[model samples]
Target chain A: MKTFLFILAGIISGILGGMGMGGGTLLIPMLTIFFTVPQNIAQSINLVAFIPMSIVVTIINIKGKMIEKKGLLKMIIPAIFTAVLASLAVGRTKNAVLQKSYGVFLIVTGVFFIALTTIKLVKKRKAEKENEK
Target chain B: MSKKKETILYIIIGLVAGFVNGIWGGGGGIFVVPLLVYLMKYEERKAHATAIVIILPLCIVSAITYILQGIYNFPLTIKVGLGVVGGGIVGAFLLKKLSNTVLSYIFYTVMVAAGLRILLM
Candidate 1:
């Protein structure tokens, strides 16, 4: 049962991650809530899982010619450095604090996603209207 | 934009996005895609693709830290990774056939639901 859940989580997160929408948001909650995994470990699992998933998806995207080299080159170094630093900091935070922080992160990002979608919808509607006129 | 200006902007985006990713293990692309589109003037598709490549390094770095901290679960990671690999292949191919806008709507709904659940927990 546990193994089944893990595989299910992986498949779902992978599909979302493959879409470049970041599957951790879903995976983290799923593991913590359903599997009784601790928040920190769940997060770590999510990160580790991403390594293989990202590699596979990235290869496909690259073959599809979707990747822009310039954008990639510009972001890789600084991103990696900061990512390492933040991860180290996460290691030091207590579980309760980390969980709360993650909660806040989710809420804020959730609202942001809704807002972005709304804006896109409005713009799309306007574009259609202009096209009709 | 000038080459130097564009380079600086991209680096800044990387810093912010990478930090979030490192802490949470995902969602960095949220920051990367928008910044690439608005600041770097990349097409949306190009931004998403470029963000994926950039994220590989960030996830690796962060994952290494988690491993060193001894918080990472190797057996589980491997198991989940296997499933993810299969799903990723399917999703990637589906990208060509699926409407991204529809996919994004689904994504947003999930994000909001997950966020509310976490916050309440």
Candidate 2:
């Protein structure tokens, strides 16, 4: 049963995650709301889980000839500095505040992307109509 | 793909994700993960971890930016990271058994829900 549950979360996370919906959003809430894991554990698990899954995705993209190695090289150094330093800073906040912070971020970003996409779609459709005319 | 273009993308994404992660424990994974995967051609898994790895450095740069003014909640970060990793393992393990149909449906549901959650809020 535990294995079954893990399978459900993993598969769902991987696919949805692959589709670009953001993995942590789903997993964090699932772990906290349903599974009742501590927010800290769940978040840590997310970081750790990302490690292996990232390896898989990297391999697949490489095989598909899709990864832009140049782009990654540019982003790596500055971003790593942020992670380590940020990790050091926030290592002591309360759980509720952390989860809520993540929740709010998820909610806000989800809405922003949806709105942006909708607007983009509308513009595309309008352009299509003009072209047809 | 040019050095200049990639540099702009990295700096922009880094600053944005870093600020958010610095203020909130959420980090760059939420936003950049998808951007890299869908727009930049990163694999899903790589997109996710790369967000972290990328954010690590960006956050440091960002932190340096803020060091003169203030600081972060380090111990809390450790706790949150623990939760993220633990849940991640469990989540990853469960993912293997689900049928594609069920899995996709769940994925869509999450996307819609996340979209709606944002839209409504």
TM-score per model (chain B): 0.92, 0.54
lDDT of 1 at B110: 71
lDDT of 2 by residue, A83-133 (tens): 556555555667666666666666566566566556656787899999999
lDDT of 2 by residue, B1-121 (tens): 7767767877777656655655443436677866776567777656654664454444344444333333433443344444344454444444455534444444435655644443343
Off by over 4 Å in 2: B1-9, B18-30, B33-121
lDDT of the candidates, in the order given: 0.80, 0.55
**Candidate 1 per-residue C-alpha lDDT over A51-112 given as tens digits, one digit per residue, 9 for 90 to 100:** 77777777777788887887676678888889999999988988777777787787788777
For candidate 1 chain B, the 10 contiguous residues with the lowest summed lDDT are B110-119
Each candidate's DockQ: 0.73, 0.15
**After aligning candidate 2 to the native by TM-score, how far in Å is the CA of B46 from where it should be?**
12
